[model samples]
Target: MLPSLAFLIVSCNLQPVSAAGTDVVSCVFPFVFDGRSYSSCTKDGAIDEQLWCGTTSNYDEDGQWKHCSLQEHGGSSGGQPCIFPFVYKNQTYYTCTEEENRGFWCATTRNYDRDHKWSYCADIRLDANPKGPCVFPFIYNQTSYSSCTTDGMSNKKPWCSLTNNYDIDLQWTYCEPSGGKRKRRCEGRWGPFDTPV
Candidate 1:
């Protein structure tokens, strides 16, 4: 399985028809679906098992969508969504990364060098996955969250901390439901994560 990126065919020339007739063609990165923010395409709520993405930033609110590919994965499980072709450190990233000891992370924007926006993929495993350093069962509100939670933020996006105890470290990032870690800087005043476009 690929990490971060929602794999798409290299030559995709789809002409999706919209009822509203709005002229937005390109897919919106890190869009919202079912209240969870996504940085890539997903099949979570697909009609026929095809990977699809919202045309606008919020599918729940806008209901605009288009096909990504023709029913790839044969109905396999869906994971966190990530935007592809994102730039980081002068390099382009098409999949998730474990750089800097951060967990499976993906740039939340098209240019990480400018925005510095990113998030960790979400994993529901009982124990921390051996792949990276993201601490599982992190504490929030004195309650342990083995997976990402939307309760901590106003946007209701999924997020988790780097340490086993968010109460102490306070380092965390919004998480993708696709697989598993995007640690935001954990310190000082709490602020909202910038929207990924």
Candidate 2:
């Protein structure tokens, strides 16, 4: 007398989430639950192995967690964000996808079949620290910029890319102040490739 799998899944999706209708809260890496340490999201205590993370740095104390995507240790790890239209197993994906019951995941690189880098999609969206590691070759004013720029400005403030390809995950970052540090770290003259486009 069990419900159909599809029905159950639908019901689960309909359940109220504490983070619903709010900006996705970034997961606290290396959290703890049940007297164990977990550097990534876990399904341990969650029904149906749904991935979850602590609202605070420690789960044991907060006891507050929200359902996250079954991402394989996703989020800013290595600063490699998901790139759309990614090639995987001779196929291309324009958005998040599920492979072998691992829930929705995306290739952190443009060619997953090559570098083989990927992570689970976030609970709401594959977004965190929106600035992200600069992806370069990004479009700002309908013009593609392969590197940081201070174009079309009066203050000469430095700027950089946030999206990988502009055509995919096309978005920019906040601040004209902290933007320089991100550029230096990710676009410096030497060893400035924490993120690749």
Candidate 3:
């Protein structure tokens, strides 16, 4: 004799996945198998789609799975050291680090004084050396400073803080007026900061 529809479903397409858990199989077609909805094979039943449920305590924390609300390639704060309250393309997202789950800091707040359009926050570091040409208003202590004449501080103590700490006078390369050189480089006359380098 043919069993009842529900009984037939349980026997054929749907089955309890485990004895202790409520998880069961509903359908095999289209890859959705969770038994949350009635079998689509039945009349008046719409196709049930699969929805991702976060892992429970039963699952290992490291092995657990969680659904992300952000779009693919979009920003998120699932990790630590993430940048908070960040917006992109009209959508707000928190910058997260996949390394160990952390939040990110602002570049401007860290004395960057530049754009803040980065996707991650853990990229901040002190050993960063910029290649090629760069704009000014940069911050540097002593070891990083190469020259000081451009900023109008030849004595090095007045311009750079590194020399001031040592209290040493900078050696100034002066040009003699009787040397017949009409142009002044660093000695008597002031140079133009507005001049393009």
Highest-lDDT candidate: 2
CA lDDT scores, all candidates in order: 0.51, 0.52, 0.25
Residue range with the least summed lDDT across 10 consecutive positions in model 1: 123-132
Clashes of each: 15, 2, 13
- The candidates, ranked best first by TM-score, are 2, 1, 3
What is residue 164's positional error in candidate 2, in angstroms? 19
Provide the lDDT at 167 for model 1. 84
Best by TM-score: 2
RMSD of each: 15.3, 14.1, 23.4
Model 2 residue runs over 4 Å out of place are: 1-23, 70-197
- RMSD in Å for candidate 3, one decimal? 23.4
Point out where model 1 deviates above 4 Å: 1-133, 179-197
CA shift of 104, model 2, Å: 16
